[model samples]
Target: MAVNVFASATEAGDTAVPLGGSGVAATVDCPDLSERLTTVPEQARPDVDTELARLDEQIAAAYRQLQEAARTADDAKLDEGAILDPLKKERAGTIERIAAVIGKAGKRPEGLDTLAECTLRRTEVATTDAPGGSPDQQRQQQNGKGEEPGNTGNTGNTGDDGDDGQTGDGQQPGNGGQAGNGPVAADYADINSVRPNVVQAPRQKNASTGSFATSCGVNAEGLFNSDNLIAAPGVSNGAHHFHDYVGNQANDAFSSDEDLAAAGTSCADQGDKSSYYWPVLRLQNGTVEQDAESPGGGIEGNAGEIVTPAEVTLRFEGNERGEVTEMPRLLRIITGDAKAFVNGDTNANASWSCTGFEDRQLKDKYPLCPSGSDVVRTFTFQSCWDGRNIDSANHRTHVAFAAADGTCPDGFRAIPRLVQRVVYDVDAPSLQDGGRTVPLFAVDSFPEQLHKPVTDHSDFINVFDEDLMREMADCINSGRECGPDTPPGSEPGQGENPQEQPTENPTKDPQEQPTENPDASDPPAERTATASAPAVPGQDGRDDGESEGKGGGSGAGRNDGQASAPPAQERDDDASPRAEPRAATTPADDTPDDASGAAPAPGATQGTGGGEDAAAGSATEPQATRGGLAETGSGLGLWPAAAGGVLFAGGCVLLIRSRRRSM
Candidate 1:
């Protein structure tokens, strides 16, 4: 039996036909038809197609499942087992086969003739499953330990394994390499070797007196009563001990019993009895401490109680003498929270006077009141003490203060007050003869607490008048006048002179004279040429001259005759001569020869000369010359005769020229 299949009759016709019942057949009418009989070997074709369809459906299902798994397996919700297990197993087997082929193929596997289909198929599955897997996970799957199939296929790991071929969980030493067992374990055997030693020290106490404990420790009563307390004969010495200890040392250093008694008396005079009544209190630390004292103790006794008014003795050393002075004046005295009269009363009843003891002069002056005075008093003294006065020669003065009764009050102290000597140390070179000295007065009161005097001595002034003169000189030198508007007796227009104005006067220019008259002869020749030509006649026998004249006896003939004559000869015979020498010497040749031929006859010369002279002076001199020529021609009849001759010659030439042309 046989069966046949054909694409077309043209292809089938060349092949032999099979038996009808047992083999495939193609009808002659349907040349392109193909058939397979049950008896033929191709009859199993339908079963083969069915098997292939089943296999294709299975492969398609597997591919779709793979795609669905890949789509859903993001890092956030990956299913490592369901997505990568089968692929990892397949990749391991494929890698083993590839390695075998590569080993047999030697250095270059590219030239080897081998089936790579399995390898490519396995690679596609492995790559899709292991797309972003970590290297360690990939290496674990490569070794065929039946590791969970979900393990990604990747590069093999080269790390050494522990027991059971697994890496140790313990951290390794030195770049994370595994530690050598025995040596590393033995190195840290003694735990105490690595422990740190620490010590705690006790805190020292603070010595600063900022706290109550420190301040309480000081002997307040002893400190307040220091000046009044007596001491034993021998105790502490040399060191800066407490006042009581220092007093004890002072008591021991005295040489005699009298000296010791005197020291005791001075101490008793301090009158600080409050120190004996105050009790010492024990601090919480069990140390004994002194209590602070109140006011009215020691020398500051009964501060508000006013005693008899005490004199504030002021001693001024080194005061300049005999000049009006300005200095700090001790006007009143201030005690503890109270002010009292030192010298003057509230009505300013105190008077100030200075007496030059050596010069025997008395000066009564009034004290200048300061701003803060409560009591302004004045004293009227006839004269001051000798030692308290100063003069120009006596620059230094020592002043001593005395009470009204000339005695100080008991238990009151007085500080020596100094009024500086007002001596001018003149710096000007013009004042080399030496500068003057004067006395300065005390004006302001002494302060309750005294401070060191200011020592800068650069600009000290003494006399008020001298100071006034210096100020005036400065004002003048600086170009300034001092007054309400300007100082008295100053020049009114000083420093304000007006600027002067300038004057102007116009000056005349020199007039220019004619250097030389413009060349007279040159101008005339140019003018003559430019003059209009006169209306005159030609030599033809036309009326070439004027016919009118006063005497009309052939005037033109007479003019012609005169014009034809020689002008030089006529000029020689004339009564009056011409002005220019060139005119006199000019020959008849200067005029045309026809003028000689046409000159007036000799009889008419007199009348013509007058006429010619008139015409020369008139506007038509050329006409006059032509008239003279015409008069000459008419008188001789030469013009008419020459005309006839010219006509005859013209007639003859015409006749001959015509005959010649005709012939």
Candidate 2:
């Protein structure tokens, strides 16, 4: 099972073709054409969007050809004539069509032909345990102390070497089933060996200190898709990877803004129709999933069984410097780069760690958790909104991350930051055997990405009703800690709060307990909301029951009318509930844990700004705020956690590009 680990970044990036364990493998890397556009004519937007999607498909087809050529022919050359030239030709035509559409309604874009030509790239992974590298050299490159040739912006360390011996299974060590693509031995690190690099930003006097937690059930209903409406509208199989979706159910490639608004939701609070999605993680154990033979699955190099999450937590945190404003309905956001392996880490935002070691976050590597500890993935989305568009030409320029000092860039408003945490309970894989005994798990990715840990990402869309959105903004601006089950001004453990402490089961919130006398077929009453929020009508005037769009709940009670019985669905064989063990207490020597379980009060004493109270000006209300030029936004992940103060540094700018070859 032993396979060749990349010796150095130089070896991998020296030429267009890099030698994998199986032979030469190449990927298509092209400039993001959409980012060059200053504006898209409103009438031509749809046609232009479709043409842009065509460009992606052209690249995908070329990459697929390269993979097939590598698998069958030894030392096959990725000749420009056979792959790149044809791809370029296809792209040039698509680019012209895009220009034609835009020219009819507005000024024609120039220099689009320059973006047609593509380059071949190989996965650039550096290894300390390999034959030609030293631990000190690897450590320096990982700590940003030094940069390897052609490996700029690669600040991830693979940690110290672990047990690397051949396993009895026939799988190759470096390749997790996909021949040249990865989940390689060098892509994982031991959590304890990594230094703690997390820094907390001090809250200023005018900061919004309130917190709001939402009870969106783990995707137990097995909702899975390969469509990305935001990135590639109207294009089926747009995202060449399977995504696990929560919140909204009717989110596919063709879903219109109105369709999503009227669709059903998976959240316990039905009023929140917002959609959240991320790539699904799969165990590379040779188990064939239902999607194994379909697009975005085995046909696209994504094999193995899909692993569902044990718990999911969706919490909204306030800005560190000032009061927050309500997010516009249909406002779209993407948190991490999905093609970071080849694109570089300028936009990479992945945070992988073990449940017990929450303090150590890995941006480019997956954590090989210790036994009894579960794997955790955290996504802290951008919290700032530009005063203008809900979506820009590149889908990112409309939103930006705050400055290091906790203030939004001028003209941008601070919005509630969504921190999604997902947890999975899987046994540590035998990397030596290439995950033969206990299967190795990797997140779903585009075929060319090769399942690199750095390419992990998530997507979101805001669909909250006006009143609820107002409540969330008020709670955060006022510095009150609230949950979906908590009233407007009340904090957890006050008023009708059901549970005071963390629950043992991560999937079932203690606050989501069912009513005592429940009907056999009726859904749970007060599933997640307090008396202040009311259930909204779903499509066809039907109310969303607990089992309406989900697989299993405890037949929970809700204060609602009975709808038709849930439609029958094929059981997801890969989804088996696993025990979620309690995480070990944070070591006392670490940074002071805020015992109040609430952010510092908004008007409290200054932090590093170090001053007395001052006049807090009115909050900046962006055009993306409620009731502006309304457009559309689209969907998408998490597993769960204990009830405690999880202070994520929200000051870091997280401007991520969409998956439409948007660099």
Candidate 3:
């Protein structure tokens, strides 16, 4: 379903919705996000049982101390932060110890070489790794704290298969020809129904399938970490946690317009040199506190503020399918709500999509893409801005999803929709690896927590020529097929012929994979209109007219949006792929000829800490190591464990009071 790109573009004029109040777009360049998955390599995979056990023990012990302190503070009527600060400090120290062990082991998956990567791996492996890895432990902790904002039945955690009634893998990939099972967040009846009182205009008119359209993009070979991070100014390296970066190969937190202008880009289309990044979510090694802290951090299992996704893909597509279009200058927009971790709800506008198989639309979640299909993560940003706020407190109020009929809102001015499709190199589903069929990845979230993986999000910045943007908008609004080779004023079919569009190749990526049994001949999905969807706060993926409070409250209420996802009908299997998904042409670990993998990535933090003090380990942090990696070590003994028991008791008391206060 190609959307009307210009919903009455010209008529919208200057102050109209698509044009922003003054026919102008905010001048900052950035972008938004979405997700899908690819498997990480398993070679040289070190069994971190010993390291994890030690880390878990330390975390438990630390939590015990923290509890005891909190209780003591309560008894003494002291400030909780005062009592907890030291314990928090200790917990950080314990985590650093785990980093040390990871650093020295050097047996982790090859591509996941950064701390963030290890963090992600560790997190996924946590359920199976630690002594605390048991559900009993999790329940016990929850019991200690009573319950959290979204801690009921793990709402969307409906056993991957039961989550979305469409059958396997949460929800059917493309139900009812709808090629998407975007991350299902909590109910957003409040926001979706009334806020965007503005009506949509008609912008989409082009009918091209983009078959001959050139596929220009960037591939983030590996994550980077460094002291020159630009987001965390004045801070060393980056934040306490690292940030994943792509696009400008040389970009760091400290990168500048001039630096970016001068730096080489990873994009096949060099003209698209904008930098992309977000906080890297680290999977906790057993060496530290891996479980989500209550009132301690923002979300449950809060390893970091955000879950590090497996990959980041970015691209552009519009009415000018025949040629490429240069992005406008410094136009930035973040999609999906970052505060979701804090809010415990999913923003409906995060257009979660899947890639890899041809024919099938690019936005289906967990679709079994055919062989040779590129595994793409395409995030569509909200085009209808309030024009008043660059960002809202909730990270959503300022934007909104486009009308399902493809119309721009009354307050929004039509602009060329920018789609950022990040491609991961994961291969088709691997049958090996213990008959388990190596699992596909998805947008990261606090594991086992109410907020499931479906809570995918993204950020974007438009750094293109303004004139070029105007031209592209004109192309889209006017329904013209313009490309880099054919600007708006050029004659039809007389523009520069672009190099042959890259064939949909999935093997270039080391971890990139495709579906195990693809449903063939599936035409492109009709939900592509999500490309220009409005992304505003409280727009929690609910229909515009959904009545308020269908099921409002904690975790379960938030999942009401997702509850609708499961009931979808599965794709008809009788249908076959127009083109058969072929077998992997290369080995799972094959590095491409033009491939970019090298030694430890620049700016990416490599593990060097062992089961000891990580003070001298890496550039990210400085903390003391205690009870270095071990499984009930003789050196550390049962002292910490014993102490934890006492603290646990005190913790229960403090929490009881805390819950009362919240009530």
Per-candidate RMSD, Å: 72.4, 21.5, 30.5
- The segments of candidate 2 whose C-alpha lies over 4 angstroms from its true place after superposition are 1-24, 75-78, 125-176, 491-663
Task: State in Å the error of residue 256, model 2.
Answer: 1.3
lDDT measured at residue 630 in model 1 versus the true structure, 0 to 100:
65
- Return the candidate ranking by lDDT, descending: 2, 3, 1
lDDT of 2 by residue, 1-663 (tens): 001322332345544353343423445677768667758877887888788878767877888887666655444444445677888889999999999988999899888889988777544443433211122333454566543333222111111122222222333442345433555655666553444333223345676666565666678889998988888889998888999999999999999999999999988677789999999998877777889788887778777888887667666767657888999989998877776665665466656765434434566667665433466777767778996677766677788765433466679988887767677766555443344434667898987777877688889988888888998888777656555555444532211111222222334442232112212122111111100011111100000111111212122221112112111221112322211111101111122223111111111111011000100100111111122323222110011121122323222223222333465
Encode model 3's per-residue lDDT on 429-514: one tens digit a residue: 21111001222233433222112222444555454445545555544333333443343353232111111111122233312221
Query: For residues 488-565, could you state the per-residue lDDT of candidate 1 as single tens digits?
Result: 454321210001101010121101110111222211100000000111111000010111111111122221211122
Candidate 3 — which residues are off by over 4 angstroms? 1-217, 220-244, 249-252, 255-263, 278-328, 339-342, 346-348, 351-376, 386-398, 425-452, 478-663
Highest TM-score scorer: 2
The local distance difference test score of model 3 is 0.29
**Cα lDDT computed for each candidate against the true fold:** 0.18, 0.55, 0.29
